[model samples]
Target: MSKRDYYEVLGVDKGASERDIKKAYKRLAMKYHPDRTQGDKDLEEKFKEIQEAYEILTNDQKRAAYDQYGHAGVDPNRGGAGFSGGADFGDIFGDVFGDIFGGGRGGRQRARQGADLRYNLELTLEEAVRGKNVEIRVPTLVGCDECDGSGSKKGSTPTTCPTCHGNGQVQMRQGFFAVQQTCPTCSGRGKIIADPCRSCHGQGRKEKTKTLSVKVPAGVDTGDRIRLSGEGEAGENGAPAGDLYVQVHVREHPIFVRDGNNLYCEVPLSFTKAALGGEIEVPTLDGKVKLKIPQETQTGKMFRLRGKGVKSVRSGTVGDLMCKVVIETPVNLTSRQKELLEELDTSMGKGEEAAKYRPKEKGFFDGVKKFFDDLTS
Candidate 1:
């Protein structure tokens, strides 16, 4: 029998990209997998077909040859036998399936690992910094109780397919082309089940919720992820289970904004308090602390509280907290208060240079005068 087109088996166009061909084959591999079908000899053939289609389409040289000669261009009888013999069928399955399952190269079909999963966990900044033990509910696929992963009815075993003689594939001829295809009767597994399990319906898995206790280390910020090995979805055909990743998102606190391990926050002070440089109360994750503002402190003056910020998980050292002081202008002033302020402003002098307390103010004005002098000159 002449070979059929590789593109036809994978259900992709001849001009399909390597990525497109892989996507089509992956869908078919997952849907018609022998692991999912449990002794449906027909499924075994289909699985092989999906595997074969992927094997040829993903390789650059093989794909190029197939595109040029269709199936016959690479067939053994037409002097292409070496190319066919050179391809390792098992390696191809391992290559694609390993990436999906996180396994290493060398595509061994059995003993596969489980899939990885993620859970979004929200926490207060305090709790995240202090570290906590949390219980999470996750949905996953577990082994089926009815079939015990055999996919056969109770008290029954699967039988090899009759049409393909347990090879799971059949030879087909079209005009001058001869190709091998998955046996339709057994789906490619080379086995058949006269009676399927009722609970899982021949699939060896069932959906159930699992409770896991995750230990969150201290000082985790938003967007940090925790990996839980062997905690993801169950693998098919009794392969290894997948891993679970817990993504952390910290809630905002009324007091602080975090940057790395540093904390930034605004502290409000009365006009008198800011002008006179007084001691004020400050908030910290651990507790309240007192900060002393130097006399003549202006608005937006930041005070650094050493060793008061969060302790990093990677580094043991604690970080500093920066408190930006905001001067609150006096509002609802009494008549006497307004009169006193006006008298004070008049006393400070009309030129107003004495009113400025910031460093380099005189230098800045002198520079500005010199700038125009240079411009005109």
Candidate 2:
């Protein structure tokens, strides 16, 4: 069969981007792989055609040569003195996975790093403010003991893959181009296990739970992550383990709400206590302390207790706790108590000047009357 133009064979323009070429090749490779098609000769021929088109289009020098003199000019094995070497499998690997997979363009791959881990830590408000040492149980992937992560049988070691010659890559020649890519045979690990280890099932890793003690610093808030090095999943082939990150989350407090470093709380005072202000016990993290209220202290009045809040981890500065008072309306009142309150109300209702102590209450009533008048009008 006469060779089709390489671009025409791939169904792409000659000026197609490298990405487009790779995408086209990947699609064709997956669709027409010999293993996928079994004994189908037509699919195998189509696969070969795609491989040839990709081989030429992905290369610069071979592509330049082929553009000038077609396939005859860039044939590496044609005994042509002017033709340079074509693409190798390694070249394509560097373009595809890159540093993200840490599969670099180095002559050989370095030791692979272990996996990272996440550990969620719960803390109470007191513990978060004062700091605590906690023991956490974590599930991790550890190296197998039988073969020490070699993925081999008890008495044997893993063998280098013969298909790709232990380079973990294979070279496929379609026409004028030769590209280096990862060896599909070994999945780029450069070795294969004939008799897989029964414990880890050839993956070279095992599941294990380990306990670790972590010290939470004082004033650490939710969303703060502390990194513990070499505490994550163990790597294959004795590679270094990755890091473990402990993410802090503070538990909800019944008494206090946190705003940054400051703590806020609503403290309740009875009507008599609010009317005739007196010292009352208020709750604090440490213990109860007597707080003084001026005579005739009103509801919603805030009292700041300095140094009763957080000592921030970053700033190391102490914050304050703000306590707002809410005057309790004496509900479920006894008959005598209700009668006495009605008598007091009659006394206060005698003159507006005598009811001067209830300015906000009077203003609210005035606003209510105005609202009624507006509604009626």
Candidate 3:
């Protein structure tokens, strides 16, 4: 039987590009592949025909000759540059399925970068707001001094792997399917150290504690990260070291709770000072400042001290300090204090007149009386 035209076999036009040819070949090959066709001889022959057509059209020289002189220019029986032992099945497989399986054509491996490291740094609120220089000790891998991070002995060097010939990978074939995997002998490094370094033992790195000083910027809050470049574990085989991230966790303050840029605190006020009004000292980060309390000040009244809070690190804007006053009742009274209190209560009068002295208390009873009156009626 006469053979079909290569472009006709692959369902593409004569002027089709190599990319379009490959695409058509892949689609037809998958459809009529021997495995998919279940050992049908006619379909298997079609698969072989598709492979032969793809091989001839994809090769630049053979394709050029066939384009000018047809199949006579590429037929081996007719003294033409024919299929050289069929198509490179490995190349076709890689082009079609390499991305799905994460395997591709083998080459020398590049140096691997070191892993990043994180250090949780605890800071006081004062230090976080004001900023300070802190020294930390981190245990990690450092490049070997003896071998200069090469993993070889002091005077020697690494040699190319014998198994993969410095390709760092080996090809495994099962019938027509080909897969590339890391070379077992070299462990995918492409190079082998015959004389291992005494210090690092062929690993190219050594574990040691490193002391580094970090400058904490002012106004940095909790959850902030400070990056120190080239301070993480040393890279494999002298590659670039990774970065060290200093994670900030500010400790809770005894007097103040910070919220974003603002600081909140509860100030205890004596009932006498709250009722009569007075100038009281309030605690701030810098120092103590006097805040005047107005007459008849109630509990939970918030007083704002402008610019007494933290300055924002990103925006450079200052915040306020919110002081919520909590009225403290007089306790541990002596007989004389009790008599003075009794006299004061007696002077405030009783019933409707006493409502002026204790307005909230009278309002509560008034609401209770209306509730019962509605229920009865």
Candidate 4:
């Protein structure tokens, strides 16, 4: 039987770019691979033919020779394999399944980093703003003291794996290709423990609870995290340990609510104080300070006290505390107080005089009158 054109086998045009050729070849290779075909002889032959075509076309010099002088210039049977290079099968299989089975050039297993751990630390608003040293208990894996992380007994040590002879990998010949894989007997460790440690039981690590002190900086808010290096789980076979993260959660304050760099609170004021005005004591993080309420101050008036809010964690800048005044009506009035209020209201003004003294109330009533007139008219 005659051989088919390489371009036709890969379903790509003669002028196709390297990327297009690779994409077409990968698609065909996956479809016709012998493992997927499950002992189908025709698919197996097709897979071999595709592999042969891919080998010649992917090499620059071989491709150039084949293009110039056709198959006569590059057929292995005719001219010593023409750049299919004997290693093509290994290279192709490595590219296809290296990540799937963790197989590659060396095939030696590597130690993995230990898993990270998270510790939630609850804090009061005051503590978060002032900072503190907190102690945390964490349960994690630690290297065994008896074996010193080697997994062998104190008096005896591990020996080189007899199966792979300390190479950690073995080669298996399949059809016309040789595939390199990790040794199953040693599990790719390259060394086998003859005597196991009593403490860690040949695992090289044991679970234990450790107490660590974490220094928290001031101005840290909820959701802030502090990282402690090498404080997590112990790695296998002496690998590096992971990190421990301290997550902060701030409790709500009864008096103040924090917003970014600002603090907000509602201040209640008596009606007499709101109207007559006076020096009042307001609470602050530091201490109480006197705030002078101006005469005739209305409800919902905002007062800003600079440098009284939280200092920013990142920027180191101060913020302001905003106070909203809410006027409280007098309650539980005595008979004499009620009579005095009525007499005072009557003495204040009437009609045009009332409008001059209570302009806002007069205007609201005028608006209501106009609304009703508009509907009736």
Candidate 5:
């Protein structure tokens, strides 16, 4: 029987790009793999045919000859120079399944870096505004001193694995295909410890507490991180240690609330201070400053204290502190004080001067009267 077209066997068009050809082949190969088919001879044969098609179509020279003069031009059985042996099959299989199986040229794996760690550092609002260097205690894995991280007893070293002969990989034959996998005996270490260390028990690491100092930059808010390199858990064997991340969490201040670079706070003003005007002391991050209340100042008035807020960590721009004045009513009253207030209230009765003195109150009452009148009408 004549051989089928390579593109037709892989279910791709003749003009299909190399990417499309590989994708079609991957789908068919995965579908017809003997491992999944479970010894079905027909499916295994189909798989072989698909592999043959992919091997030819992916090769530049063989694909060119096949495209111009068809299969006979490059067929090895017909004495033409094509894939006469399975020289490139390993490369193809690795390219397809290497990620899934960790397949590669066999050798001992590198020592993996230790896991990164996070430490939540709570900071006061003042501390976040001003930078501080803090020391922290961390419990993590460190190299064992007993065997010098070699995982063997003193005066003895690890021996090469007998099963894989230190290659760290063994071959699994799937029909004509040989898949390289990590050796079961050595667990890919390529070495066996005859006598394990008493302290860390051949793991080469032990649990210990380490003290590290972290420098936190100024104006750092919540969620900001300071990285301390090589301060995390020790690596396996002799690999480099991971990093430590100090995550900042700013505690809520009772006096002020921060918004980006700005600060906001409500200031309680006495009724006398709001009406007669006075110099009131307001608390700031730096120090107390006197804010002059204007004569006849009303409640809910906002005062901006420029350059009195936090400086941005990134931009270094200063912000203003916003103070909203809230007029406070006196709780305890004397009979004489109540009498004086009554006299003052009578003096400012419903008149033109009363409208000027209490414009907001008069306007609110006028609005309420108009609303009720509209409802009745």
Candidate 6:
């Protein structure tokens, strides 16, 4: 039977690019692959036809010849075996399914990089605001000292794997499919250690504890991470080391709470000070500062102190401290104090006269009276 046109076999037009040809081939190849067809001779033949079309269209000279003179220009029976022997079948197969099998075209393996690590560091509010140099001990893998990370003895070196011939990967054929897998002999390292190192036991790294100093910058809050390069686990076969991340977690303060750059705290004000204006001491991050209280100040009143809160780490903008004053009523009154309080209460008369001293109390009761009168009416 006459062969079908290569473009028609792959379901692509003559103007299709090489990328489009390969994409079409992969789709049809997967559909009619011998393994998926399960011994169906027609589908297997269809798969071969797809492969042949893909090979012809992807080649520059053969594609040009086929486009100009049809199949006669590059026919296998004419003088050569056509484009079958030009490219490696395994390479084409690997290009399609290399990621599925976790291997690529067989070659010497490169040394693997080290693994990253994370260490959580706890800091007090004072320490976090002021910053400090902290010393941390980390247990991790370090390069072996005996063989200098070679995984071999002091006097000997590694040899190329005999099974894969130092390629690190071995080809596997399942029916019509070709796959690449890691070589069992060398475990994908491409080299075998005949005489293993005593320190690390044929491994390029050894476990040990290392002491590192990390500088915590000022104004670093919780969830902030400090990266220390080349401080994580040692790489295999002398590759570059990974990084260590120090995660900062600030401890809760006893007197103040931090929100972004601002600090909030509740200040206790005496009843006498709330009634009569006076200067009261309020606690801050730096030190105690005097805050002026106005006459007839109510509870839950907020006072802002400029430039007394935390400084932002990113923008360098200083914030204000918010102080909410809570009035503290006097307790455990003596007989003389009680009599004096009763005399002061008597001086302020009931009804309208009392409203002059406590206007908020009068307004609240007036609202309550109006609400009940409306409900009854």
TM-score of 3: 0.72
**Taking the tens digit of each residue's C-alpha lDDT, what string does model 3 give over 1-377?**
87888999999999997768878998998899988999999999999999999988876657876786677667665445333222233444553455335465547655666766779999999999999999999999999999999999999999999998998877777667676777899988899999999989999999999999999999998767799989988888888887788988999999999988999999999989999998999999999999999999999999999999999988999989999999999999999999999999999999999999999999999999999999999
Put down candidate 4 lDDT per residue, 207-317, tens digits, no spaces.
999999999998988767788889988888888887788888999999989887788889999988998999888888888888899999999999999999998888999
Of the candidates shown, which would achieve the greatest lDDT relative to the real structure? 3
The 10 consecutive residues of candidate 2 with the worst lDDT sum are 79-88
Model 4 earns a TM-score of 0.70
RMSD of each: 15.4, 17.6, 21.2, 18.7, 18.4, 19.1
User: For model 5, how does the per-residue alpha-carbon lDDT over 1-377 read when each residue is reduced to its tens digit?
Assistant: 78888889999998887768878988998999999999999899899999988988876556876786677557655433333212133433443465345455446644567766779999999999988899899999888899888889878899999998987777777777777777799787888999999888999899999888888888988756788888888887777887777888999999999987889999999998899998999999999999999988888999999999998888999889999999999879999999999899889887667998898888998899999999999
lDDT at residue 365 of model 2 (Cα atoms): 84
The lDDT-based order of candidates, best leading, equals 3, 6, 4, 5, 2, 1
Superposed Cα RMSD, model 4: 18.7
Candidate 3 residue pairs that clash:
none
TM-score of structure candidate 5:
0.70
Against the unseen true structure, what C-alpha lDDT does each candidate score?
0.76, 0.79, 0.86, 0.82, 0.82, 0.84
lDDT of 2: 0.79
Candidate 4 pairs with clashing backbones:
76-81
Q: Tell me the TM-score of each prediction against the true structure.
A: 0.64, 0.67, 0.72, 0.70, 0.70, 0.72
lDDT of 1 by residue, 1-377 (tens): 55556788889898897657768987888899877998999789878877877877775545766676566435444434225323344444544454444443421223334556779999998998889999999998877788886678889887877887776666677667555565789775666777888887877778889999999999898867788888887776566677788988999999899987889999998888877887989999888999998888888988999988888987877889999999988899999999999988677663455536444566687789999999999
Where does candidate 4 stray beyond 4 Å? 1-96, 99-105, 177-182, 350-352, 372-377
